[model samples]
Target: MPRARVVINREFCKGCALCTYACPRGILVISRDFNSRGYYPVMVTDEEQCAGCGFCAQVCPDVAIAVYRE
Candidate 1:
């Protein structure tokens, strides 16, 4: 399987969890920590589990996510 890299602009995330719902792999979660904007950020539990499907990026309202295959 191809390895995927998921990069999130933590500061821009609003803890919407849209990506979490969009992920078929179930690798995403909303973090308890707040960002500079005082909003919770979503995090990828494991890049190794990412499928590079780009679903997370597509659902992100902030466009704070990017996915690349490695």
Candidate 2:
């Protein structure tokens, strides 16, 4: 069995939350804390739910999300 993970670039994240909506497994969420841009960034609640579908990374306009499966 392999493990899956999702990485988020906080500096580059504008917190539009498009990635959260794009995730099919409901693993992504909007952080309560706002980023420097005053917006809530996307967060991965659980790595285990990730299927490495890359929906988050693909939907991110800022290119701040990366999904990996190992």
Number of the predicted model whose TM-score against the real structure is largest: 1
Please list the residue runs of candidate 1 whose C-alpha ends up more than 4 Å from where it truly belongs after superposition.
Answer: none
| Cα lDDT, model 1, residue 1 | 53
Error of 1 at 57 (Å): 0.2
Candidates in order, TM-scores: namely 0.93, 0.86
Measure candidate 2: CA RMSD.
1.7
- Could you give me the TM-score of model 2 versus the true structure? 0.86
Tens-digit per-residue lDDT, 40-64, candidate 2: 7878888877889898899899999
Clashing pairs in 2: none
* Residue 17 in model 2: lDDT: 80
CA shift at 17, candidate 2, in angstroms? 1.2
- List where candidate 2 sits over 4 angstroms from the true fold: none
Query: What lDDT tens digits, residue by residue, belong to model 1 across residues 1-70?
Result: 5498899999889999999999999999999899988999999888778889999999999999999986
Candidate 1 lands at a TM-score of 0.93
